[model samples]
Target: PAGDGKVTTPTGVTASKVTSGAVVLNWQPSTLTTGDGPIAYKVWSNGQLVATSMGTSVAVSSLLPGQNYTFSVQGYSGTHASAQSAPVSTTTAAAPAQKPVRSAYFDQWGIYENAYYPKNVDTSGAAGKLDVIHYAFANIDPTKLTCFEAVKASDSANESNPNAGDGAGDAYADYQSDYNSGTSVDGSADTWEQPLKGNFNQLRQLKAKYPNLRFTISIGGWTYSKYFSDAAATDASRKTFVSSCIDMFLKGNLPTGVAGDASGGAASAAGIFDGVDIDWEYPGSAGGHTGNHYSPADKQNYTLLLKEFRTQLDALGAAQGKRYILSAALPSGQDKIAQLETDKIGAYLDYADVMSYDMHGSWDAKGPTNHQDPLHDSPADPTTPIAPGTRKYNVDTTLAAYTTGLPEYGIPGGFPANKIVLGIPFYWRGWTGVPAGSNYGLYQSATGPTAAKPLSQEAGLAAWKELNPPAAQTHWDPVTESSWFYDGTNFWTGDTPQAVQARGAYAKSKGLGGLFAFSLENDDASGTMLNSMDGSLR
Candidate 1:
């Protein structure tokens, strides 16, 4: 044996089992004895000493995620040291993106005037990250009491909507209207011969591009829920409703009379729709669109309706060899959710994304400005004068209403957290004519909602891309966890990027499924709100 007290160098140094923050290294033990006790191994990362081990393998911990590291191993026995093993390099894995599903509503009407299209989802890069895209406002046939597709031009000044019970929807936007190459998902113009030419075809293109994408035809939104009560009224009604929906959306049976060169009929839109999202504004509440039908039986019938959809969807899935999604756009208002059998309806849903925004809006026309989407209730809120001292009109209370029901509120606390997705709004809720108070307009009185926006934008309402109140006028409330704007006259409330990241953090912390927005059109041209959501929900 060599008298030099050094041990022979270890060979075959290797790095494996790498993660975002750690990596494991292994090597053949030094074969030659140093003529001193035993040998221990030293591990180095990026040329810095990091770990020591008695065995041939050592694991390096506390490394940065997605970092590139170069590691080497050395063995020593007593005062003697072996030459370093050959180094190996590796890049730590990137951290997992948001574990919860990220979903959003695609307002079909956004195409008419907002000029948003299914192609926007692709161009904005939302398609690559989204879990579900709920195509909003598929109508319920009032006469047949079933799901159907049709379009009727809207009348803003009219509250007594003639289309309230007429199975009215923008079918022209759904699959009938043509998308030119510039506005189409694949840069190809939709032709007359194509059975499906509009948003449905563009969605199909987006779907093909993103394998994980799911498109659900959302039936019974705020405007179209007028006939939901009739559709979900009884066992027979539920069966008829669920079957018609499955056939119309999942099975792609477009009504033949949609006004476009696109001839519509059986199987015209098959494979474009993954499932259905039930958005009956309220099962037994009076707060929906003015004439929406409601009955006390809606609570039980809501659960039964979900059950019927689940059963029928499962049966169809068995035949098609694919699982179809079934979700509901849940209400956030305590009173509205109270009308639902939260404990029961959850059993049949793949997801129940809470519409957590719109807690307060211009509807309270008289005064007392409010933050529409508070993550938590503010002690500073003036709502006590409006109603109870309780702070029940925020995001936390809404999520808890389902995932961990509030017993005091009659909500049963046991729905699975991972199945629930939180909703974020991409629009600002505002009001005007406020008296400049000590807090500007934090909760001051206002004569009414703001002036009506042009292009038919709702009065006192603005999309995320529209509002840019001055920095001097902006305010953030940490107690309520919200941000707002007030220039001593016009008061506005909405989700800033910081507020959005906070909500994403909230979703992860609560073990919830993910986050969604009320609309795709409300996002800034850069998709600021949507991008913030995608990056932070992890």
Candidate 2:
């Protein structure tokens, strides 16, 4: 008599009831030849001969846990060999656990000299929520104390001056003192300010308090961006400037005794500055101080410069067994995109902070000051049109600028969703010329037509309540998805707690990292704005 000539086990042979040292393999029986007696079978483990079997079921013992093993069976037709079934392998399940996610941001002027300490850090009572805080080092007087003290003194002097000093006087004085002064403490030489006094030292304290928090020194902003063009014009200058910056930042040798730690100074420096952020305002555009005459080489050379920085920092980190980060704050316009080779630059960057605010303002001709980012509608409505190209400000425009503006950048990790902190203005914009009954009225500055006029939080809230009280009036702008109180004369452009809630929802929907208010002091003392942001974002 001949045994079955073919072995026909079901596809996907699986093992069930598997334990630490045993497994149960199950499969349908194979067909036997018409004249052959019930075909005998032999089950092999890992394709090796293991044991002969007469039934379809088999329980293998002494198997290792979590080990993958293949199994197959063979049939016999008398003395002739039959085909073997396909092999099946089983794998053990891995233990369950959650992976960690990293977060960072491009904070606007986070390390101001006088205001960068824990005293100003409200923390919303939720300290340690941030993993990385990128301080935009705008207006650093390497020759003078950081710009914070100067700005504070300027503010005080202006408040006391006959004409309040205005903008020109303070700016000129600061420029002269910062650049012309040869004094050691004038901030000419690079040195760490007294402990917890200057921005850098305050940052050191912040890092110490929040062990996981990291800091980055960002260079460049709207006013002082002119130097970047000059520095990048020549290879020698670029190398020299970048090298000096790295050395001053890392070694603190220029102005001795300013560094946070003297013992293991190199390690201390490494600990304080995890990276550097380049905030070249409008690299290729005419706007800001970066100069309007950059050639095509500037764009290409910018990438090379960043690459050089990354290479040098990485070399240092490797030598010291520590890791350093690299990032940049990109312009918020399409014209400036050419200044950076986004694709090449993205590879070397840890994150890119996109300035999504300041897209519209009094710079445009209009009566109502709309939201910086409107969720819907154009700046000017078609029905009661006031100006051309004026619409509600919203994230859609910002996202479009980054996506279509720098498509080649590939923007590793989806436009830095978490790193893409939304810029919220603590102050509001206003104007005259609106109708008496318009909903946009709140308070107007009689002394000045510019948005620089200071508006107190209490006064602003009181005026809004008196004019368009929260109960009677819900400051709603369908066009901007923002609310404002029109007190008949001035058109106040400020955000409410409700508007902030909507912004938080929008940020979450867009997968943004967090929200950053322009100036912390402008918020209500009770911290209505900050608390709202914390609740929504945290």
- Candidate 1 global Cα RMSD: 18.3
Model 1: CA > 4 A from native: 1-98, 156-165, 260-262, 385-391
Model 2 agreement with the true structure over 39-154: per-residue lDDT tens digits: 44455664344333333444443234466667776664334445667777775333234212123333333223212223244243323444445554434343321221123221
Q: Give TM-scores for every candidate, taking all chains together and pairing residue i with residue i.
A: 0.79, 0.58
Give candidates' CA RMSD values in order.
18.3, 22.9
Count: clashes, candidate 2:
27
Candidate 1 structure quality by residue, lDDT tens digits, 191-289:
665456678777766754564577888987777787888888889988988999888877776777665444456555665677789998888988887
Q: Least accurate stretch of 10 residues (summed lDDT) in model 2? A: 165-174
* Per-candidate local distance difference test: 0.76, 0.47
lDDT of 1 at 420: 85
